[model samples]
Target chain A: MSYRKAYLAAPLAALLPVQAAAQGIDETINTIFADYTGWYVSLIFADLPGTNFSWIALWLVVAALVFTFYFGAIQLRGFTHSIALVKGDYSDPDDAGEVSHFQALATALSGTVGLGNIAGVAVAVGIGGPGATFWMIVAGLFGMATKFTECTLGVKYRNEYPDGRVSGGPMYYMTKGFSERGLPGGKIFAILFCIFTILGALGGGNMFQANQAHAQLSGVLGEYPGWITGLLLAGVTFIVIVGGIKSIAQVTEKVVPFMGIFYVIVSVIILLMNFDMIGWAFGQIFMGAFTGLGVLGGFTGALIQGFRRAAFSNEAGIGSAAIAHSAVRTKEPVTEGYVALLEPFIDTVVICTMTALVIVITGVLNIDPETGLYVWNSEAGRISTEGEVAGVELTSAAYARAFSWFPAMLAIAVVLFAFSTMISWSYYGLKAWTYLLGEGAAKETTFKVIFCLFIIIGASANLGPVIDFSDAMLFSMAVVNVIALYFLMPIVKRELESYVSRLRSGEIKRFKS
Target chain B: MSSEVFVVAYEGAQDDPGVLGYAMQRAAVEGATLLLVHVLEWSPYSFLTPEELEERHGRRAKEIERARSDVTGPALDKVKAAGIEAECVIRYGNVVELVVEEAGKAGAGMIFVGRSGSQSVAARVFGSVPMGLAQISPVPLVIVP
Candidate 1:
């Protein structure tokens, strides 16, 4: 073996013994914990049957669909109103809130519109084939309805501090809404949502953002000790995030638009460069989506892969965006709700489509005719034993092949995208933390410090299992948020009617300054 | 002896503004003075001189006068027919701080301000200003939504 291979093998070999030792301890601890909590574990685990559909995912989809139906497909009916909200057509400076509608959307977009669009889409296409993109778009469309409902609830239940500051999100809505409805276990559900949101803010929001940033930095800068990137990101994040949402919004309004436009422009260039293959590439997507082509275990597996990745990317039903959207400066909850609908459309429909097209057009994969397993291109010098290329590397390679020096540019974009995402998520997590711990300087400082530390942790360590668990926790939040929205649909309906009446009667138009 | 109350009216929203102007005119009719304070919130950073600042505040004051005319025009004419005296005052600073200070300066017993509604629906449901003013203001604040 070459020296590089020998070097790579050493640490992995060294880990074996450590893993074995740790496994022994883990097994013992598991035995003790399992004995102590046997019934609880059984109850939780028993819910999961190894079926094709994930019960959690299914529940989320059903919730999203039901919300879409219950709200009279407000996502569709309110599309024009959403546009007006973004345009600030109805905006008044004297309104009781912080930030503009556009700023709120951008802030929320920055949180969801990160590496998941790039790497997550790549993984989906890689595993589920092209048809998955269709399902993802469908899911995203339904997700807009979910976003609308939850964001409305977020604004509805928000608490404004004495200093004219705002505090909101699923935690407030879940508890306050439920209590108003006189539901039992409202407080418990609220507490649970808070706990899950905080965990999500840490795992998905904080660590995942850090991990992606570190990856892009390492990829571009050629692995010059992970802590260097970690420290730099942590410091920059601390400065920006210390100022809170106002600071975060100001930055995102600039960053999200620039980065989003830059990526879209690059994707357009790549598509134009390979303009002829666009037809064939789309064909493969359609064909692979349904037939599964050579993929092992047939169409079912591909469908699962696509749905999972799409859900991960858009976070439509997850309700995390509602936390960001609640701070909008509108009097009409449905107005912000209308604005929230644009999130999934922008995130999933526009951005994810760009990613899926790029990966498909690149033609990197060689599928087995019968089994559909990807064939290694050993002679092409791009194949690795890792079974799959990392999402960032795959995207980088695609760009590099398209424009020769483009990988370096992509690496820079990735880092910026990831860093922006981390800062936004840090805010989300901190807000969630404040909701749970109360708004003290010490608690706030502690959350920020811990969040920053995770940048280093995510950069320096493997986060495979951590990200998986984090993802699960994030989806679990959707469960609670959607349930609350369902019970509170009547309130949303009332608000919708009132807003529409005002709009139709020209009450909104007649208001003079 | 009765205490005086000041009502601040925005340029538009006729129904509410009319009622507010009528109320203020009635308060003056009842032998209590009415002071209408409007602050431009035009920052010093936006202008070259205190003169320029005054100019901007003047224009805003005229706009407030137009609003005052609309409110106290036909409505207050009727109130004057019923015998009420009303005055309008304009100042500059932060809206909340100026509103509070002017109320104190005028020695007003109570302040009546109209809620402009929120720029977005979220702001309305959460009740931002009412929640905020309730926390700090020394005097009672009644927010009309």
Candidate 2:
């Protein structure tokens, strides 16, 4: 039987009642089983065909190139400036806004740096082989332009409520930017963008984060029920989120740096242990990126997968990070824009490269002697057909192989990393929900509770479909957000010029003291 | 009866000192007492060493007193030049809480704050601390951009 037919038939046949079973038994069995099966079937079927994106990746490559050129290669030109912002060279207490430049960068990074870096990179390497890492770095480099444009617009169009609060993101740019440009459908597009953003938050920012955390917890603490893990995560997340951005920032400012440093240090140690294979791994990455193994499909597939994972990881084009960047304290929006360009670099280029290197350097993708195709033994704790590995298990394996008895330590790191990410994303999703639902206490409470509940749901329930749907929602948001950004480019240019003028005129002097 | 007004500037405003002058002028015109308050939002780590904390606090106190002297000196000069009475008050806490408390302690009828320019209304509403205080402040708050 065909895959689809067999998939449908098995579920239907399982629902068929035994001859001895009563009508009540049939009803109870069907009701309980039907809902789950239906959800699963839909999830598997809903997988989009073109999502693999063989040709679109090339288009993305072209767009990245054009954006870099049009922006005067802001990524390279402003690299020093980006570093300065992080180092607090220009921070001024007199600056009007919310958080510091560093805090704003951390907040935005907290949103972008999550499971997409971990699981998504693993999937790419699994399907496309090690070569995908090279294209990923390429995509990450070009993505800085996209990041700059969206963030510049985010600040330019941000709304300061009469109450002195700031609300900015694609929602503002979509409406105000387009209206200024005389677009007929500005409000409609803005409303649609808000809706998609809210959906994306629920799916990508909330559910997916919970799902991954749940997976990791389940993997490490298999004895504990998944629902319990979800409950614990939900409780901790609620405390941080209820305090809003200030609290979120405080937590992430500490958590992100620690986790980022911790992950990098561990990856470096692992790489050092396998010092000999480093050269070979780099060689494979370069060769596999361009040359298909006896076919065009492999080469292109690797390229697409690499780009896809990198795009998803850094979120340079997605515009969600802009919402966070818009909160930065600065009279000059372009200052924050420059700060934002560093996000893709840290998230995709630095952290993700480390993860990719660990996986590839470990020889996780060994060539089968019989098939001559790269495959891992399912029993050997490698990438399975089901794509299930203990959260950080493969990385842990590599580390453990290098330094015996390190899996436990690595497990602790994984849990902490996942925990920090979940808490950060909860804030992002909550803000998006607040944008949609308004700031009513009832609405805020309901969204927070529901969001917390999802952590439990994500932990206990099988989240394969839920995460897939969330991933789609996140990328779909990028589609709408990036389009809005194109229309708002003029505002970005205006802001940049105005800020640069002020800088040159010394109206806004660097904080020398 | 004229109402009192207090203007507080954080760390970065010390350079211009014009904001202090401006606050004094507004107070003199209204026959209100001008209190210039500067707050130090120091980190918790600063308290780890008692000696360090004392030294830091001493330096911070000196800075506040200097800023207070500068404000009241020029402010009183301007007030006396215009034939008005003015005073300067200095204290510290959380920025928002300190401002609110000092506004009450000084019994100022109104408060004036500098505005960070060129932001949309929504950005201010969701993210700005001044905006948040304005929403719920017991007294009228003026944002000077």
Candidate 3:
């Protein structure tokens, strides 16, 4: 308890300096982040030779395409069975000696379904136009195969300690899966993956979430210093992560699923309210996706933005979900893979699509009436909008059109989503940290403290450099993880083949309807 | 061999256990066996945090162990002390369904359920275990007040 007081005091103590410098601190931090991380961010997101497309975006999309083919389009073929598995129809109590994966899937969904669905889609549709939504669904569909492959490897190579604890992710699979295949550089790959995972957890997973939460709040509560929100969020986050408070974390986890459902319901109601405009929206999406409809970079621009945001949104090839899904209780690793594939579908295909549709239907993006093209704001480098808003602000504005009170509700949702994402990523970062440094209480506490501190940094900093750096780190993980997936995919194929055969042959029994 | 096995829906130590007493008397009279069934209410679809999901396996094992020791184990000793053949089954799921399934599997001649007579809204709306068993039990259901 004394240590708890010390931990609580640490953030408050640090806040004084932050508040003292709050005037120019935002610009200072943003500039510093950009200066330090800009080279790597530029390199990772560098456009392909002779193209405006990011090679990393292509990296993820290509890997997903390969997985989609290599698994014989398993995302589509296994769709019905994945639903059944999630519904607990295939779970046998005798076989489920441990907890089932339904809850694991739900937890993973909460982690991915947050700001990505809300804000990321807005960015995509705002820049890429409605057509970005179409490619987003396509990417999401293909990304399911990537999730299936990685999560299967996640479960197969996972380390089970004697204390009934388990740990797994791309790092484990890279080392073990590669060693078994006599591949060189397996350890190097594992180390690289761990490094990227830690940074990604801090950047995309922690800071990006906090930054957006602050922005959403500022939009609603009038202008305020970002550090004020940052300190408050960091303090509460410290209590939950460092203080070992399960009740608060549990309450957030419970509410997140309902929030996801409520978001979908609200989006559906808004869509129904403009039911007549539905066909026109899809037409815009279809046209914008192919022709880009005079939008910047034309067809390629829409494709790149759609693919980039979808990769960010669903996290198909990113491999973070693999770490979460690996902890599921299952003897058959393929079952968890089946359960994992549903994540991208739910996050990108279903929820992200809902957001994209609402944004389009709400008339947030300014359209040239005669040309029927999204008005490209040359200065802003995205579509000209009603308030020149982008990201989560654009989303809040769109939803506010339908319901005057929606912005306030969206603010709360943003905060909750940000908190949940931070908590989830703290675990992810801890896992990667321990993977690199080995596990211990002192080591874990250090990571947790650093993680809480970054929440303040993320909250206080401007979005430009923080998002760029985070996206770069996250994509770097995919660069390592997808390479491992290529080598280890055969093992997943074997597992999937055996399971599907047994399933069809009736050797695998279903316990309930 | 006495084929009669009376399924006692053991409601843990919280209830009166008058149903267990009634089942014990009936089993003794018929020289029958008492099958104690304790179903811990659980759902696989319940939401959990990542830490909770990670440690769920360990927690579930502890829960089953606690239920056996704190609830079923004492009831089994009570039934054995009464000089009647008995066995106990513990599982995690919907109480009524698992109890009925266990009863049918054990070739139960009757099911003895304790009615706490709870007026709680949840019980009234969702129906208590006794009410559920009364509807779905394959064997004769006796609600002991």
Candidate 4:
């Protein structure tokens, strides 16, 4: 991702001195990126032969399935226990005013629940049809196990400093867990993970969010230049991270989660309003999953898009949630695992499903009356829809069907989601940067400066391949993270077994009703 | 055990020493014991990051230490000098509820609380602990100026 961006950015940087002489900067940048990274993008997002499933998406789904079985379907068995943990039922009240399982989950959800559910889901249904929703739900269910496994290990092998700050993620776990198992290459694996994490944080977390947010703002507020938005985001980020305006930061943290709840509530309202079509929408999703109906790629198209979107949406196997969940104040690490598993369920199974149902029930997808399938818009390579729309716009249009003002609401949601994701990623990236450079005032400040710079570029520059490359970096993180998980999952199993047994015996006391 | 007991709703703010002084004198005169109750204003619904969550144990430990060193410990010494038996409690929750509960548990004859002096609009709008305790106190309430 970094290489591709620099390769594309160098000439653009040179053109800065002569922008009037060399016009069409946006088109030029897009063309250069598309040409240079086409092969790499294909390799990253390549389909598996006759099937539509990308290998990266397959890797995530397979890992989720493996964990579901390996942990004896911990997601399902521990679901209620996870809810209890989030609710602080078993938490000691003496330790109140700290991060609860719910807070960690909320923070992590803010990271994943951004544009993926809004824009990414629309892209899926546009191509894969409503049947893709079924696959997305399935993938999400399995993904819960992956979250449980990673977060259990996250808390178990975290670094607790003298100052009471804790740091945990694939980097900590890969190094610590691997070393605990007498492995020699833990440090190298950890270093690789950190590198990927930083890059992923910059591209997907920072730049992509800014870019998408700009796109949304422009969609609503007219064809305003992107830098204005970029400057605004950069300024806010600078104030919070650099200026040390904690009150504003606190308001932001609160805003992100409240917006998330608000989005879900609105989706619920739309669903209830379309009450009669709910069951019929499910029928379409189920039938489309197998038959593909008017959708392209038959059953495989729907499954691939669903799996891809779910992987992107909830981010279970990516190991980012582990960082957030690791801070949970529980003696039993398994409690955090239970709490973490709820993330995928909420992000994918609930939020994404709500978005999909609203899209389907509203009859946004163009359907062939004869075939009773989603009308295939082969040029767009997904299911055809009214106006041939895709991405966040399609989701906006669908919601607008229920309420005319919804697109405007969605635009606000898009910007908020994008901004919140950027902020969370800033933290994630900062941690990775610190891990690589060693924690210090200077190193941290330097990383923050670069992060701010990228937010600007992401908002202003139309570098399609660069963002795509960053997304590749994100998927690459899952690759390294899951490899480390394979080595470390046994330890998680041991923790889960012990916690579950003790709970069954009433050893873990519940202090709250 | 003393026949009479007095509870001081001590937040240990600027006027807390005055409140404690008033309560200590009253207790000594009536041959009553003292309960120096300090509530470390906290809510379960407050937002906390993961780092804050991990440090909750240490933070709670510090809250208790601070309560002892800053408020209850000094007040306890003052009461001892006055020849009145006194105990301390540092708890977490609503100030009014915790203060009243501690007073009731100790079987106190009266509760002493500090006034906010100005009775500013901000305090009235947001609601003050002293006002809350006055409304809810089970026993006779004394507002220390």
Candidate 5:
């Protein structure tokens, strides 16, 4: 990487000191980002004493489990109805929510279904081996309950302005739901959630997206000054974000879903092409989940990686989906919950599993012949994947094995995924920002300008600290959001019970059979 | 018992008033009740951001109101003045699809659609609402000049 930089960066250095100055700033930002964010990161992701399990992960899992039982497994019971809702089958003209089920689902899926499904899955499989796929699926299934619970509360407590604007999220529910129940501390938790969401929008949603888009672009275009990519991305994003192009959102709402379907179709084609290996691949996945398949720690290692990546990819318990789902048009808030539950399932259970199966079936992870363990890349200090690649590159390489031209397609998909995610997060971050700073044109523009600048920073800077800080902030959102969920879930339960009874008794009007 | 219905697909652009006027005359002659169906041009499948989705219900309602009051209301009044009972319908969806659907629902005998002025490349390739109606409307579709 350094040699490529030296070779590619010579002209920019000789022409001017601009690139040099950017590098210096990158180092300073990285250091400061790491220093200030390290403690918070460790605190959220820390392993429980004498166990590899993280309290954060456990908190999310237990909440999902409890919600699953409390609502009598609403995820399973309402799964078909959720599909029906999205298809406009049960949609009533008088019961319009803000957005359609499809739009709300698309918006939330765009946020969760980005590089994490591609890159994060690769990393999990690299470290935990094939067994991780099984656990990831399990985690994603339970996560549906979590998404259902929180989004129901989101709509129940959402603030709809008379002018037709709507703002509802974890922050609103945290305060409003708690206050309604006569509980204190909702104010503080809500405030903390907003803070985390703002920082998270900057780091995970904006910068990380910019950063990976840069990496993919540079890989395809040959090593170029990162700032060039950053500037181009930032400029385009500013036009779309600040310019308020409703058409772009419409285009993405169409395109992102198209891309997702395309990705899965290709995955299906690859699996069919290697038709004989499908069963064996499932065997490896199932066996690995329990026995750990000679990977470092066995069952526990696979379980941890599966849970962590599923959480990262689907964000079921994070409460961010509530923000997106709350915007859905539904008279019954629980109907949105039914719709929101499909997000984690689509993201983790379906998409992530496709990437995982492709990696395992394509024989991407290098295995030690004698020990049958995943080979560690001593130089890269990670598990050696096919062609000694890792992260998103490994997923790309695995797909390339089926179609040599797939890497280029994957690159395009990555950038589109990043772009859609950034736009969505800009909204998420803006909502939080306006909540804290108050609504005004100047305030909104200020946050937007800063967001666009961070896009450039994310694209231009080294990923080490930027990604680290963002991932931490993103998880930190979960820390506050989950606490709110615990308190607010009963509210969701009441909604679910009423909605279900009405639905069964033919009280909830269905416009379509 | 002269309660026959005539469906007029109203775009309400420059050429639309002329087409609607013709429909009103035809309805008056036939003693048919006029059903002015104005479609707001919406696709249910289009994706929306959080902000867009949040304001969608309000925007859609506003769109419906504007189409009804501003576009169809005057036409309906003019037709009523011409001794033809008229009702206005505002809907959201493809112009051709909604026109046909509303026509069937209202039991209209004929449909009138205006030829939009701009015949740009996109309009040519995608086909105009009148062109679509010519291909698909169950009732007789008249393309007004």
Candidate 6:
């Protein structure tokens, strides 16, 4: 039977699942998820009729490019001011209650900078060869303008409560922005966005993070029950989310930055150790971008992998960062937009590029001396690696070649990254939950409990279909949010123009030199 | 009354009270107002959790209120009871810099600060508040142990 038909018959088929019991509960759950949700996953990820390029990736890339041209490349023009804003050079002391531009950017970074940097980049480079890094950086640069537009609208249209709380995101902008323009379907779009956000939160945000954490732990500590890692992670998350324990969040917040710095330092050390190879790595990346370096589908394959990973990694048009940046304490909405643009630059341009460089410089991928092309393994369907590893493991192997202790440290970092990502996504999901269900303790707690439970399920099972479905839900958010951005770009443009003129006239005073 | 003011670098109730007493005596002797400055150490570049970000505004307001009512307010009352005119300034930033800036703005003849009792290596190696003020304070600095 078809997967769609399987989903419909799941309830009745639930009685017939005893056959897979000998394979363990994880296997059984995986089978069920594959059977029931496979159709939805296939639909969301379905490529163009003749091409391997995902329409969702194209949707995001096109929107980013559109924003780039429309804003006069604000990401480049306003780059200096964005740095100044983040440095608190223009911040007014009176605006003390709002989150500082730096804090907002850091918080948003913690959310997007997790597994995507470590694992996702490896996947792109592994399949697309070095050339994928070029497209990834390009996508990241264009995505900055998209972040500028959405975050500007996010702050402008945010809902400020009497008690100093804020609620914003694609949902708010879609509803308020659409209605303000006298457009129909504002509320409908908002509701749809929230639904997608909630699903995306539970699946990609919570479950996928939990699964990866479990994988990392098992990879290092030896195989144990996945539920043990899940329970531990869930219990810790539950305390933070339900009990309002700030200590874990505080610790993670502090460590995540140090972890990022440490990761960069190690990568730099490895790069320096292979200092002479830097130029060669760049050559591989550039040549691979245009010629695919002997990868499958050649040029198109490299471009697709690079763009897909970057779009997934940085989440420029996904509208999640908008929610986080919306809380910045600034009277000038455009200022936050300037600051938000840095998110993609830091996430994709810097961190992801670092990963790709390390992979290439370490000589992890085999290259045939005759053709000077990456030795693609037909059986594995990707470039052959030094350790026959993939994803984060490949990254670990590359670094471990330099430092034997690197993998253990990476394991800890992976857990921390996953935990922090989960916390940030929980907030995003909670905001969407409150928006849809009308905000009460009981309703909010209901969502939080379910979220924590999904952590257990995610860690315990190899639910590929579930992850794919949630990933689709996450990308689907960009679809609805980007459509509204097209309508709302004029508002952002007006705000930007007014702010710039005032700034030029010295009507907006600088608080710091 | 003289136009001169003495800027007292108040840390908190946990700080040594000798700075406030010394500043008050000098202010009374010179017939100048005591400018008690309290700074809550804050950096905009610091990392914050999502919950903290959401409640930062409320927490900041509450922090200002608590500093006013619990720390600076009582110091002002003590100065007023001593028959010395006094006011207070509370802000959030680097302590040494803000205190020095407040002294400059108040055009104080002298700045008073308590000796930092921190024996931590970071304090000794990096310099303490008193050390910082000693290096940068435009006016005369009084370190009351």
Top candidate, metric lDDT: 3
Which residue ranges in model 6 land beyond 4 Å of their true spot?
A: A1-23, A96-98, A378-380, A463-467, B14-17
Candidate 5 lDDT over residue span B21-111, tens digit each: 8887788788788888887766656777667777887887787787777877777777777788888877766778878988888888999
How are the candidates ranked when ordered by lDDT, highest leading?
3, 6, 5, 4, 1, 2
List RMSD in Å for every model shown.
13.6, 13.6, 4.8, 5.7, 3.2, 6.4
Model 5 DockQ (Cα-based): 0.57
True-vs-predicted CA distance for residue A455, candidate 6, Å: 1.8
Q: Which run of 10 residues does model 4 chain A get worst, by summed lDDT?
A: A14-23
| Clashes (candidate 2) | 28
Worst 10 residues of 3 chain A by lDDT: A1-10
CAPRI category for model 2? incorrect
lDDT digits (tens) for residues A1-513 of candidate 5? 456546765655563557677667667766776787778778877889998787776877787788788888888888999999898887654343236788788878988898889877987898788888898999999999989888889888999888877889998998899999899999899888889899899988888888778777666555666677778878878888898766776677668778989999999999999999999999989999999887777888888788878887898887788998887777889888998999989999999999999999999888789987677665765567766766677888899899987877888899889888888888999999998889999999999999999887787667666656776788788888887888777788778778888988989877888
Give TM-scores of chain A for all candidates.
0.84, 0.82, 0.95, 0.91, 0.93, 0.93
TM-score of 3: 0.95
* lDDT, candidates in the order shown: 0.65, 0.64, 0.87, 0.80, 0.82, 0.85
Candidate order by TM-score, decreasing, is: 3, 6, 5, 4, 2, 1
Per residue, candidate 2 scores C-alpha lDDT tens digits across A1-513 of: 445435534543443453234334334433553465455335423423665444335545665676688778989988998888777778763431235667677767766776777766776676666778888999999999888888888877887654345667777788888888888777777667777666676666766666666565444444234555666777777776654434443544566566767778978998988899899889878887886332225677678778877887887777787777776557778888898999999998998888889887776555656854556434632333223443345555555556655655554555555566555455555556777667788887787777777666655544445545665556667667766766777777777777777878988777743
Off by over 4 Å in 5: A1-25, A94-98, A243-250, A378-381, A460-464, B14-18, B114-145
Over A469-509, each residue of candidate 1 has an lDDT whose tens digit, in order, gives 45666766766766777877777778888988988998876
The list of candidate 3 runs beyond 4 A from truth reads A1-21, A95-97
At residue B27, give the lDDT of candidate 6. 78
- Error (Å) of candidate 5 at residue B99 is 2.5
Interface RMSD for all numbered candidates: 13.7, 13.2, 1.7, 2.7, 2.7, 1.5
In terms of TM-score, which candidate is strongest?
A: 3
Ranking by DockQ: 3, 6, 5, 4, 2, 1
By summed lDDT, the worst window of 10 consecutive residues in model 1 chain B runs over B45-54
Task: Report the candidate with higher TM-score, 2 versus 6.
Answer: 6
